[model samples]
Target chain A: MNNADHPTQSPGNVAGIRRQVVLPLGKSIEIAYNSIRVRFFRSLITTLSLVLAVSFLSFVNVSTDVANGLLATGQPELRQALVRAGYDLAPEDRRADSSSKQRWIVLLSLLVCAVGIVNAQLMAVTERFREIGTMKCLGALDRFVMRLFLLEAGMQGLVGAAAGALGGALFALLNGFILFGGQAVRLVPANELLLSLLWATAAGCLLSLIGVAYPAWVAARMQPVEAMRVEQ
Target chain B: MTTNKNIVRVTNVTKTFQLGKIAVHALKGVELEIPTGQYVSIMGPSGSGKSTLFNMIGGLDKPTTGKVYIDEVDVSQLDAYELAWLRCRKIGYIFQTFNIIQVMTALENVTLPMTFAGMRNDEAIEKAMGLLDLVGLGDRFQHKPFELSGGQQQRVAIARALANDPAIILADEPTGNLDLKTGEEIINLLQNLSHERDVTVISATHDIKMLNVSDLVVWIRDGRIDKIESRDELTISVGRIDARNA
Candidate 1:
């Protein structure tokens, strides 16, 4: 056969011979997609749980702060005084409703995310014992194996974080528009959305690492023979 | 590739395993030496510690006592990463189950060890193809492990084991899973490798038919060498010799 027909038969044939034949194109995306596909429903449930939990805690924190501030200022003499002092006794009806809902939503989302990460990592590790072994046998050190899991989890985290942040902000904005009828009810921190995204990603990784620890340990110590013996 | 005369040296090696409360002795004071480019087969019954011996020699397990030296370097003292590196650079391994990664194509499986050895992706892939071609699986590069038959898969495993151009190929029951014809083909291929590549082959097997093809036969019993035989000591041709003559 002609050399042209054999793509792997290049001038650097010897060098080409040594690489792990990773499939070119769509590998990273495919890996990410598959990881998400395996954990999507569970991750949603987790994210929702966490969102609710965090939101509730945040509301508690904010309300407690607002209440203390109002108390410190004593009772406001005028209706506008409370608003000016950042302690509207009546507050806009829509703002009150949304702020209340945000508590539960944030808590729910956080719980959902944490649980989903644990589940996904556990499943991924369980399913790929042989693959891990093969990598080890091929001379992969502990750090390399850990890196693979980290990368996979990191990708999943990015996806989940982006989606949660966007969805959450939209929900918050929708609540504001409906309640205020296009009027302002204090400032909405746009930067918090970015912060939330970053936080979600970091949390996703942290939770996944916790889940992956045992499996990664097992893999790191796995004898090449045991890995080879595992049934597909 | 060190041009070392003594490739593998084993001295007073002992291995034991704790299975619950009982301690199972796998190898006891085993001392052996394998020179470079030797083709040897280890034969034994099940539970005879032949597998354990192979594992130790392949650097997959550390002996409880004594030391293993490959290319005159003591392997027992090396750290995990260094030991892994030694396995990657110095030894090739073939398993009875083929042990080809299911998620990877044949070429990928073959090239995987080189990747761990720090070879670039392109170089490893190209070399993997060449090795596959050498093992007569050139056209099946993209075939996943499950897609191939037992014989085909074993060929892929052989290719994988040879990927790093290691001096020694450690095969544990290489043809134990194949039928008579396929097993013979594998044996022939291994024999050809011994002759052509001058690679040191250490295989553990129960296949009586393989004796004819082996340069040296080591019978292991209770983790000890019962008898060591060179090809000149054998008298009988067990099978197919008369047929071929006819």
Candidate 2:
């Protein structure tokens, strides 16, 4: 280590003028994982909101795909069975189309999910105010603190979204079996269901990042907020 | 270079905090200097600018109207990056709450700052182990903060504060939460550590026990230094000096 500390009380001389390196992303991810595990219940609650919204979307998608596939089969026996099951085959194009009402519901549900995430994260960060202050006092840069929060949120989002998508897809399958018997399983293509889940999961993860953005920024830029607390 | 003896200097420092519509003067042109390798205690009643003064010295918050210098570097001049380096390498903070991360084990908590300073994991672990040993918590390295007693947790916090070998250790009422015996032990540990490491120890404390181990006691009243007394001066003013006070 160089004797880089100049001791002349110069105006611009920074103390301990040595190279500073940030802790790697891997270390932060590890810490974030540990924190989530320790606060498992809290994290579970945050993940639940994400799960509900993503599942709703995937359910709508998979159910539509199954209904479309059954309709597109076009065989008179299957069509007659579909009519018996209350299927409206007229004007139902090859492309699966959910009504505008369902689209509004999806948009509303996702917006609610995002708002829930932001609220939960903000409260969580507030509860960890002292922890954040301690880390800052220990020389954690703003970027490091931001990274920790984002990583934690991202992990929760990923887990919750995948679970929701799978659950919704499975539910759609069971509903299909009950409504149309063996024909339901044979008609619905698996690839469409898979595609719906992939995008649903990605959207959930992106929402998580956007949700955590403000709280993480608030956590990072503080100067050990407790510094001004009265000493008694 | 400034005198090697003085590690911290404060000149005409004032801090005004705006609560709502009015400005609260937290520090009122307070000036003081702490010598290297000395254990100094700052004492005051609540709302007397004790914490504000401490913040200025620690460089956790900048002064509103003056300057604070640590190791001859003007605190007000450094940007955030430079300021972080100063905090990381030049100053160690011990809080009253023993604010060790609750999720991390004692060893991990101690190693955190070192890793932040860019020490490799293996080396950080080795150094952290040595620090825990020094603080007498080597056997409890795997214990989380919740698992440790108040004193033991404080000891871990001490090890953490020393992780980067800071030139100054700022203890904010470190003994405020401990029982008398544990508090005394902590104070003695701090006193000895400062002497051995030749680092300045600055504590904002209410515990009179601190007066025994401290070489100097600074009393703040109403946003200004009321008096500063050497240990010898304090001893004579009260009664005959104790054997340890000598």
Candidate 3:
């Protein structure tokens, strides 16, 4: 009888919520959206911080690429004059990318972006400790909890990054025109600038995901009793 | 009691917590069996390990040694997937703080567990509405947790607990946050559900009034079962339910 039961031993025939399937991804996304909507002001602050950080980083990247593109147009006198004025021009052969100094600025901006994301995600995880516990008690799997947090972070990051990237690229274009006049538009390096914007937006999403990974793991692995024991 | 009739079995269970350099034994080879459909209450002073024992039975925590069996399946040996399966279908939890999803409406909160159970959306909503009506919150379906009174929030919680029609209901201090009058009402409701639905109700509580409705009361002292008494033996034990001892 024991072996006979083994073949048919999914929890019960009445309910289909066993190991065969998990809560739908769409439902988790809906829950994530609703949670963000419910905490409108908090979500706003998190998105705003992402926006500012991504904008700064993207602006740096775009302007650097524009500067490099204009410097490589084979104008030696112009380049020397620019170099004399404290501009660190790259070698002619390597005038294909942002300067090393500007790359460091990009890295710095990314660090600041990561710090902003970490703060927002950490706050979200702490606030949802009890809720996470309750969800676990209600049969939400570890993957489900992780997915819910990632979904929220991804949604916020995507929106903020897209807006920030576009805003930064446009502003960078305007700045380039002001500094180098018609020469700037003539050597716009539109492809490189667009690539930087894309990279910045992707970085925003990736960093948001990475920022939430630790907290999500912690939440998913928490003993429900320990989580529910917390009063606040 | 025969193992066949017992729905829950705790055998030689020992749980140790590491607190700094000290090892605190929460349960020391504790053995217990709860028959199907019994309304059991676990009572003890704080730090006496009753809550830890409750956690073991509820599958919220695994014992460091020995095993827990729910419906003949060894729960301590189950993986997370199987644990979630058991929690989703076999047992329901009602927290003292009424841990309903705070952002959703009362109706939405009750429907959540059903969704985890893979019920259809409309069907889940219909059942959830019925449950709310049963808990006397039918008219307040749209109210969020903050919008409801304490008693109302707890009623919603109870409704949520019953959403999946779990065979076992675990209430951890269900009436702890309510006033005496409301507390009594919640207790009566639980008692009625226990008899009416034939579901096993295990409540870890300090409310002395629970004695009136319990089928069995298990008292824990330190890390061991001090006594186990049926409803018939409760009259003799009622005098022992002191504030410090409970």
Candidate 4:
């Protein structure tokens, strides 16, 4: 509160004050992390939904591959069942059909998970009206606000994707081992398994970024006065 | 530091809002000049556009047809990014709700603006501590907003508003949520900041007590300035009225 300590006007300081850099990336990410921590249950629910969807997708992919491989063994009972169902198809044809169907199912599941993410993020944005306003009043650039939300969504996506992939892989391994004993190891292509997990992770991250884009934009464009006037 | 030059100038500023196809005039060609290091209180009833005018001066909103100048620089001419820099470096805002980010500690809340201004983490923390101490909240640095009382929370908000060392502090009904005694303390704190630091402090308030401490009191009605008088003038007018009644 000392008068001398606080200068009323700094000589020739007008133009110098205008050259503000965007907020540091590290600080924005830290704020996003704190926000995620504050709303732990909400974020967890959104992430868990993502995990389930992703895991189901991976499971479809792995299970179809394993199923196709098992059919290739020329097991009489399985072949007879196929015959009873009037397929009477070769193992190669069945594998191709299953691969196409798995692709469709994975695509469908991702769509559903994307919708869930959008809903969750919208709700988050609505709840944080005052918080966003406060940030803006504190001189946060719009891009900084947008980046914080995108970073939060990215973090959730990464966690959910990793967990989902691992869960799906474990399920496939267990199901194969229970059914086909020593042959299960050979049927579940270890290399393909690694690639699918990576794909799932990438897909999850992309989906999250897309889902949060609208809400982040809305938050970034909010007028500070109007936002603060919103009833909490 | 005290100067005759006006730190803020509002020139026939008028603001209109389109609310559901109906035009509502919030400010009606209001003109005023706030000199450097002055404590000015804008007093009006609800819906008198005090808050709207405060927002214009603070650069939170633009006037519909008039200009707002801070240090003689026209605010309306600046782009969004420039306005943000102006808000960051030249003006601080305190709201009635004491809008501290609830998730952060008091110290963190105070440091947020500095952080946005690109201050390094260590320097920001050090300055934030000083601000907190200045507002008498040094002991509550680590406390969250929910853990503090209303007055304490408002003190934290005040510290936060001062974070960037802005020359102008715009407070919109800062004591609207506080009790009488706490409200007085906050008013005293603001007055002291104005007097000691040579910062221009402008507040919009319904509290009559604020008029006693303000160097100038502006009365508004229906989005227009009804009168502007110094505290001494107001006191003299009141004395004349009291003598006539007696």
Candidate 5:
């Protein structure tokens, strides 16, 4: 009549997931972990697709900008206009002057990170309807529900932000070295690193709130009867 | 006849839900009084407004018409924050599915309401453990809902309902999902809570076995009270076992 009815109670019964693997919040952490893991995969697909799209745009934009800058550098009339633009056929100095291109790429990455985080957070919220409803039935107020989900997003955001910022900085640093070969190069852009980390956290919070709004609203509006009616 | 001693008073309460263009009347002109320390069961077929009544009494929903009073306070008039406070301090709920948080231990589930009541974490955990022990889940304190059987889960839920020392425990089909033997165990637990602890227990269920544990049974048909029967009198009218089947 009691837990003796549980099939999993018997030892040697497949030795499934042990009850002892307790996370800090245990089940909530598992739920959040699973949800974010799934989101991480989905974000991978989204990021890859976005990279392709942005790469094409970047090639076109950079080429066009460089051509325009050089053309503008030319006087109204000049035979050997290549030298007139001071866009030396030499690749070294030209690359150094490519700060404008660096700015454009960084801006694009920022846009991509924003969209990715927001998309991931929104998807996570949509999938947790029953969880949110359960919280509400347990007497969670609207703001309390908001805070819990926001915490979930915050956790994921922290991970994603840290990873993304570190990844961007490391890549930029490596590329700076590669571009300069054995020569001196500013591989550590302290300002860019700081800016990206800040942006990462902000993006995380923003996306999480955006993602959580729909689910939070759904949770707040649930009637107790309706909430309890949800099956596993 | 409303009395000051009534813990819950519903006066001509009505509830309506608008689904797109159609309006659904969940409860119609329902009036009732439940004095303190009464174990009452509400029974009706689907759409009979049984759960609707429980919802209104628990302050989970607002009545479209009339009013709901808890301890003479018009809970229907309270704002969302006020209703939440009342729910935390005065009401406990048990659901058919057990509705225990899946990720939380039995003890944690029991202490959830206290957490909302703003108790310190350690205090809530200690009290929750005490409640779990009281409900016979002492050995299963760290067990999750999925780890417990149906009856044990319901016990955890009962412990949870008693968590805040609430005046009233509102349960919707607390035993509907359990096997007969398990259901009986759950009923016994609830009955003990009502009789021994003097907690006002209001349950909405179709389970005849559950009615055997109730002090009073309120039968509803078509959103109105069809009959009210006292267990002792009903037992006298027909033998105890037969009365339940009847």
Candidate 6:
């Protein structure tokens, strides 16, 4: 008998309707969104860390340009040292110094942000032990689980980066106006602001993905039995 | 009670866990077969390796030695991806703790397996709703796991187990967390699914009451099969004893 005509056939059966199995991106996103919603405070805290880091990075970048400009007129030796260290001494070069010090600051801030992302994701994986086990038992491939986590991290990064960019831009604008008056408008160039936003967002997204890699691998490799044994 | 239609076959399956330097043998060369569409119960005391055997049959774990054949496919030989496909499409699992994702609603929980199987969301939801209705939880679909009663949560779990129309259902202490009456209802539901849907229902449980509905009760002790008894044989044996007493 056909499944539809069979007495035992459940409403759940989409018998005879077959489709090639593709990655369920939409469902994965929805599940990730639901998870974020459920752990709203924890997710918020993690995202906030990214926000603060990105904002700090952007603000420092802008303030350095302003400081370099001031130093250019005051200390010839300092300006020469900064120029040797790769600062643009030319007044038109608003991009300022790509000095080793600035690079160090950027690297340190990113490192801190990356560590925060890893810690948050690791805790999240630990908290969802049973949930992960249940998903594995229900036929979720390891890659599927990994994708879900990566997507979650990406979403957090995207939102956090956007917010941080806005905050940094505003901070730089206000601080410059207070410090340099009317010249502050010209100090924060439109192109530079846009570029900073783009770079910060890209970096945030990349950092988040990198941070989740180890945790996602650990979660994916967990045996269903071992994972389920964890206290809910 | 061997049959040509054996759907699950196990041959000398042994599992060992290396706990630091000590090796703990969970299953010691266990061997068994379960025929198609049968309700088989693995009954044993705690720590007797019944759960380990169940996990083996469900493809959740690999045996240290020997093999497990589900639908004639050597589960031990299958890679992770193949094993995941087998689990997603051919086998369903119910756990003692009712391992429904707490963050999801009953409908969402039920839809998860299908989602992993690459079914579209709308189609999965429709099927999930149907499965919930079949399990008498249509009204509880919107409720989260914590919001539902123990019995209702288990019903959602059962619906989820049936989500992919799997041929084999592996339940590890399916009713362990429920009260007697609720446990009985769950057992009745499983029994009906086995009989009517022709799905093989294999459970590892300590509850003796499960034997009443099981076709074959396999007794296990110390990681070994002590005996295998069919329900009809049990009934006949009971009848003879009652007659002698009379």
DockQ of each: 0.20, 0.54, 0.39, 0.41, 0.14, 0.30
Candidates' lDDT values, in order?
Answer: 0.66, 0.85, 0.82, 0.81, 0.64, 0.80
List residue ranges in candidate 2 displaced over 4 A: A3-21, A80-89, A227-232, B1-4, B238-246
Ranking of all candidate structures by their lDDT, best first: 2, 3, 4, 6, 1, 5
| Minimal lDDT window, size 10, model 4 chain B | B78-87
Comparing 1 with 2 on TM-score, the higher-scoring candidate is 2
Give candidate 3's TM-score.
Answer: 0.87
- Give RMSD to native, each candidate: 8.6, 3.3, 4.2, 4.4, 11.4, 6.2
Order of the predicted models by DockQ, top scorer first: 2, 4, 3, 6, 1, 5
Which candidate has the top score in lDDT? Answer: 2
- Model 2 lDDT per residue over B57-159, tens place: 9988899998888887888887777777777778899988898899999999999999888889999999999999999998999998999999999999999
What would the per-residue lDDT of candidate 3 be over residues A162-197, giving only the tens digit for each residue? Answer: 888888887877887877776765686778888989
Candidate 5 structure quality by residue, lDDT tens digits, A47-109: 442333233333333332333333343333321343443333443323223346655775676
The per-candidate TM-score of the B chain, in the order shown, comes to: 0.91, 0.94, 0.95, 0.94, 0.91, 0.92
- Supply candidate 5's per-residue lDDT for B143: 81
lDDT of 4 by residue, A1-232 (tens): 3222222244344344444535787887888888889889889998987898788777766655555565666676755544453433664554423456567877888898889898989898888888888888888778888999999999999988889977986787677666656575576556667877887777778888898999899989977775447255
The window of 10 residues in a row where model 1 chain A has the poorest summed lDDT is A1-10
Per-residue C-alpha lDDT of model 1 across residues A62-138, encoded as one tens digit per residue: 33333333234333343344355344346432232224555576556555656655665566676667666666666
DockQ of candidate 5?
0.14
Candidate 6 residue lDDT tens string, A85-139: 4445684553465567767887898899889889988988987888888888887
Q: Residue B63 of model 2: what lDDT?
A: 91
Kindly list the per-residue Cα lDDT of model 6 for residues B1-246, writing each as its tens digit: 234488899999899999999999989999899999999999888788887888889888889999998887788666566666677778888888898899899999998888877777899999999999999998889998899999999899999999988889998888888999999999999999888888999999877668889999898899999889999877764467568979
TM-score for each candidate, following the candidate numbering = 0.74, 0.93, 0.87, 0.89, 0.74, 0.85
Better of 4 and 5 by TM-score: 4
**Candidate 3, superposed: residue stretches over 4 Å from native:** A1-21, A64-97, A180-193, A230-232, B1-4, B239-246
Tens digit of lDDT per residue, candidate 1, span B1-246?
454476788899999999999999989888888867778888889888888888888888889999988777676766664666666767887878777877667887887777666567789889999989998999999887778999999999889888877878888788889999999999899889977888999998888777888878888899798888778774354334445667
Best by DockQ: 2
